[model samples]
Target: MRTPPPRVLTVAGSDSGGGAGIQADLKTMLALGTHGMSVVTAVTAQNSLGVQGAWPLPAEAVRAQFRSVVDDIGVDAVKTGMLASAELVETVAALLDEVTAPVVVDPVGISKHGDALLAASARDAVRTKLLPAATVATPNLDEVAWLTGVQVASETGLRRAADAILSYGPRWALIKGGHLEGDAVDLLTDGSEEHWLRAPRHDNRHTHGTGCTLASAIAAGLAKGCSVPEAVRAAKTYVTGAIAAGFALGAGIGPVDHGWASPCRQPKVSPSGV
Candidate 1:
């Protein structure tokens, strides 16, 4: 009866666990008042204990799924995660090049339990192909080290990390400093302007989907026409609440609460408001 909301798409693996990957991305989009779509790049046999196994889809299949949504339904923004191989990375990056939507590239390399998601061989493709096409590249401390070889020990290294990330060609870089010793701090910069986002470090361990959720939330905000800094700030607020409310799922590290921003379903405000 009314116009559809801004459409956001996640191109990532399927987490059978439902705490991360495509599941978390879609949940975050809905929580942020955006329509969610998916283009699965891989499938993981996983649970809270750990990832048991993973299998990447054919590159053509990834391409087709992306086209199926983009050609007919269209999209306002896109987020990418857990691309398993160099081929898939290049494929998704190429698809990103063809679209005008703002892209949030989460260079997802490892799982919460230390399982490798992106192949080591694929790192090069992600840096040259994927990162170059992103509107904002979101990488945690560990991811930043592997992708940029710059190990950040404290808050001071955040600016250095952002510089390394921006050299990859993203319009903006969000260097997630969650692993730092003190308060959870992050650095966002576009070489000229900078926004240092900090939040109290919530003492919670069930943060399995933090990367995917934050990146997707940023995408959702961008879809609603927020600027890069605006989208990232709002995403930080949402994820901070999520981490604080995280609950135990299985015998191991659990997941952040994607619906933490919404206690219960409230009446829609506007098509663009979350």
Candidate 2:
């Protein structure tokens, strides 16, 4: 008999540019050896430039998609991003209540091109409804400020931000501090112990999908049977490599190379060790 692949699902928006959101999530999952599935909550006319327009799907449609996937195919882990509205957030949260897998929540508030994806009205829904259901909540610096009113200027400030996010009831909080100067550092905590993740800054402009990609990668790790901290550590390493191997495609910021493994951009080694 053939072995089954680890299954992972991404609940997010569709990016026309295919560099972020659902596109990036799926790419990351495939590269990390998992079967990727999606339930798109919104569609956006986006590119490396910016978001031109957006249309959010109805709550019924969102709920139906979640049921279709969860009831049959059965996900091992689920990652959510870009819900766009409070109604959609609540709907997803309620649907998640029925899912048995671990949940990775990337509170996608703004895009790499500086377009707002989640609305100001929906912040409360994300905080009260969606976040509490998360196995781990991944939020970048801007989103940290948006959700908790705390600014992470230095590495030490990540604790305060993590505490505020933990108050929402997620088992773990992964606060991404890539926006800070010098090294790209992230903080992971469970309201008690703290894990400070530090990596050398790649100085790459093609980091368009870092948040979504990292969350999805972590979900993929969980689906493959890794613990939360182990998954996070692996994801951080993977994303750093992706960023280091990133390429410029469009006129604006491109995306981190999800296919950082298996000789996509880098040269492949032969059996002869050449």
Candidate 3:
């Protein structure tokens, strides 16, 4: 019999566009060589344009789905995104607390088009409950500003942002500086050790599911037994390649190509190293 791949469970909302949310999480997991599972917390009528409608599932339904997977399947890592309401955030946090696996919280607050994915009231719940259960909390600059009052104007502000996020109790905080001007920079810290991840900002405007993809990629790395920094480094490399290969999808913004790691998509080099 063949050995099974590492298991990763994503607890998030469903994106009708198949770009962000649960869709992106599973895609990232599979691309990173993990067995991905999901527990849908909400269903959104969304596309590249924007979210048309969103309906959060009941807390019981969310709990049931989590139990069904975790009790039997037993995830090696978990990634969370788009907890729409305060109740849902707390419920998921409680369930995550019971799981022994490492958890990666995306802390998704808004969509690619500036639409809110998380309820404003749930911010506190995320800080107080969800964050404590996270091994890593990945938040973009906008999310950092939303969760913490610090507005990241430059790379200097990233440390403050990471510190603020670390105060919430996650083992590590990854403050993404993609929204800033110039190269994309991200700061990962655990209130002690720090890693600054920088990548050349590809001028791709179709990076719709970057946050979800990165977080899920990190979870997949952790599930495969990588250290935190090693996992983050691998995830950054994967997401950077995905962003570079992003292509146009629907009428509006598109999604990063999750299949960028496939052999056919690999960049070809000349024998003369041209």
TM-scores, all candidates, are 0.95, 0.96, 0.96
Indicate the TM-score of model 1.
0.95
Using TM-score, give the best candidate's number: 3
Q: What digit string (tens of lDDT, one per residue) describes model 3 on residues 69-151?
A: 99998999999999999999999999998989999999999999988989999999999999999999999999998998889
**How would you encode candidate 1's per-residue C-alpha lDDT over 1-274 as one tens digit per residue?**
9999999999999999999999999999999999999999999999999999999999999999999999999999999999999999999998998999999999999998889999999989999999999999999989999998999998999999999989989999999999988888899999999999988877678888999999999999999999999999999988888887777898988998887756473222211223
Question: What residue runs in model 1 are displaced by over 4 Å at the alpha carbon?
Answer: 264-274
The lDDT for every candidate, in the order shown, is: 0.91, 0.91, 0.92
Model 3, residue 156: displacement in angstroms?
0.5
Worst 10 residues of 2 by lDDT: 265-274
Output the better candidate (1/3) by lDDT.
3
lDDT of 2 at 69: 86
- What's the CA RMSD for each of the models? 4.1, 3.3, 2.4
Candidate scoring better on TM-score of 1 and 3: 3
Worst 10 residues of 1 by lDDT: 265-274
